[model samples]
Target: MEPMDKDRRVPDRYEPGEGCLTTAVRLPVRIVVLVLVVPVRLVWDALAALGRAAHRTVLRPLGGGLAWLWRTLVVLPVAWTWRTLVVAPLGWLWRTLVVAPLGWLWRTLAVAPAVWLWRYVLTPVGRGIAWLVRGLGVALVWLGKALFVWPWVALWRYVLAPVGRGIGAVVAWLVRYLVVVPARWLYAHVLTPLGRGIAWLVRGLGTVLATLVRWIVVVPLVALWRHVLVPSGRVLAVVVTVVVREVGAAFGHCWRVAGIISRAVGRFLGTVLRWLFVEPVRWVYRTVLTPLGHGIRDGIWRPVRQALRTARETVRQTRRELRRALFGAPREPQPAAAVPPRREPGAPGTRTLGSSTTALTKD
Candidate 1:
């Protein structure tokens, strides 16, 4: 080999072990640090990547399934339980409180219309009926007056006064038919007997009364002497006047017996009447009056209140109708008549006054 080529070649003494000291040191430190930490860092990064991917892969489907299952099982049951336990009862309570009152108010509102109809319509009809009745009464009175009194007045003026003179012209016929001779016969025959009968009845009654009084006075005194005084005197005068005293005692006993019998009969009749009628009346009073009085009062009061309401409505309707008739737009008032103009005295001799008003009419 040439000398230059041999110089380009590595020298035998410049060996690999104879490198730069800084390069040698730096290369060993870098290699050792890489050897110690590079593989462990690579393993840890790979494990973290795998863990993140596994977490995503597992949690995605698990979260979706769990959400669906919760909606189907847990959430639905809880919602149903709430509806059954809390919401449904609350809704029922609200309906009972709110809807029931609303229904009652609606019914009350409906009843108000019926009441109004009765007041405005039926009340007016009743008032009209009353007015018609009053008019009929007045008409009847006028008709009665016209038929009875007017006819009598007309007959008296047009027929009876003139016909009464004709009756006087038939004096002889009247006398023969129903005048002096009949009067005298009636007075003689009927009046005489009637008077005599009345006088005889009166005289007879007076005589009977006087005889009764005399007998009543005399009989008591005679009986007193015959019975009491004679019996006592005879009884005292003798030891025991048996016949006279027994007769007097028998008369007195008869009177006492009659009185006692009459009293007993009257008392017995009174007792029977009390048992038959009075006890039943008292029982009925207690049962009906005391216990059921309020019910009876309400029963009667309802109809009477309705009747009073109807009567008040009728009166109000009558007044309203009268007001309408007097002041309603359908009826117009009549115009006043024009007064005649005053003329001056002795002002003009032949001046003619025109009519005070022309003919006026409503369309």
Candidate 2:
């Protein structure tokens, strides 16, 4: 290996050293944070667990049951009633009274006539009316041209146009001398300067007003906002940020602590339950109940079942003897092959005109 240089060295597992301020700050902060967080965390976790348990055990089932009951008892019945009593009757009445009559009337009167009129009567009549109206419109246009448009056109072109031209020339000349020249001169010489002075005064007044408004209203407001309100808001924001950060940190720590506590508690509870209830129950099942069940089975159940079987056999024998004594000994059943009377009757042939099925002919 190269000689280790003072400036260039291989780094190992690096552990950063903490300052005294950090070391002093961390322990008390952690202690204070733990103190603040623990109770809140425990309470929050407990309430949350309780809420979850309640929802699972009580609220969810209750809500489901209520929903089921509502659906079954109220919604189903109401829907059935509405469908059966109201909807069905309304549908029947609508079809029977409203739909049938209106459909028939519409089809018979309105639709049939409308169809006939549209197809046969109205089509030809409307075409004829359109043709007549078109011809009349042409004639009316000719008459209108003669009566109105031609007269106006002639008046404008022949008489009124020349008079209007002469009047326009005179008016233009008079207006140029009387109105236009004087107005242009007044605007250029008098009004322009006066407008410029008025505008300058208005601009100066506007500038003064702007300065006053800036000093009296805007500047102070700006200053107050910048110097006073801004600083205040910043301070409030810092305070709020610090409070929120601490609260957030506390909440996180509390949650972890609470979780640990909750786990410990749960373990303790589990242990207690195991030792107190589960172990005892298990022991009873193993030592007491199992032995008792076996004893009941071996000592009582088996012997009782065997005795019942013997009693049943004795009763069956007694019944058989009583039956034999009462009815005398039962004759043994004869074989069907040995007894011809016990054999089935043969199948009969179909009766015909030549065959007789009477008892007299039967063999």
Candidate 3:
């Protein structure tokens, strides 16, 4: 037994690629999956087909019955009513009432009311405003004339006369003080130095600008010729030119597209404005002129006149109340003594003249 055990080699550690155990584990799993998954998929497919077939068979008759019922009950009456009533009445009413009244009213009402209102209310108000404005304008013009016309001219002459005299005096003084010595000294020393400095600065700047131009603009051209032109020869030049041209063309196309878009936006805005303001006004005038005219006459003019009449009545009532309050009520009577004489002053009294002889004063 010991020799048999020694003679038998111990089994090597299990390796997946080289082991039978792994094959045993994998084979059953694959077989199980194939067995289970295939049947499940087939059943699912069969059930789907059966469900679709049943749905088609059942739904067709149901749809047909529903359509037939709808045709019999709902559609027929609605179709008949629409054809008989709505379309015909709209056309007749539009022809008789809507279009005709609109045209007449707009023609009469639009211009007349605006013109009348302008004449009555707005014209007075505008004239008053214009008068007020003109008064203010005249005041401003008077003020401006006062401020600028004579005063400024006199002030300018006064100031300029003194300045001119002073300048002339200063020039005379300067000629007396500096003509011989100081003028010659300034020209010889100061002006010579200033002119030389200006010339030197200008020449320096010109030299620096020339150097910068040579370095920045000329060096790049030389390098391009040496590296790009010589190495790639004509192809590089052609490719660069083509690229630049394509870029320019693209820029031009973008500009054109932008211009077209801008024009389209402008036109769209113009069209929208026309539709919103102008076309609607035109349609309204065309449609409802007579009705609008009647409405204005009845609605606005009548009410305004009625209001003015009511105001006048109120004013008369107020005046009567004021008179009664200030004086006395008209129904109240006066005493006989308080009343004035009924006979003329030239007529004698009923009693005899100088009958009593007792008088308060003698003349």
Candidate 1 C-alpha lDDT tens digits along 233-276: 87666533433443444444333343344445546766897889
lDDT of each: 0.71, 0.79, 0.72
Q: Write the per-residue lDDT of candidate 3 for residues 132-234, one digit (tens) a residue.
A: 9999999999999998898978987999888999999999988978796788898999999999999999999999999999999999999998988788877
TM-score of each: 0.21, 0.50, 0.26
Clashes of each: 0, 0, 9
Q: Identify the superior model by TM-score, candidate 1 or candidate 3.
A: 3
Candidate 1, position 265, lDDT: 53
User: What value of lDDT does candidate 2 attain over all alpha carbons?
Assistant: 0.79
Ranking by lDDT: 2, 3, 1
Task: Report model 1's TM-score to 2 decimal places.
Answer: 0.21
Error of 2 at 136 (Å): 3.3
Q: How far is candidate 1 from the true structure (C-alpha RMSD, Å)?
A: 65.4
Model 1, 330: alpha-carbon shift in Å? 15
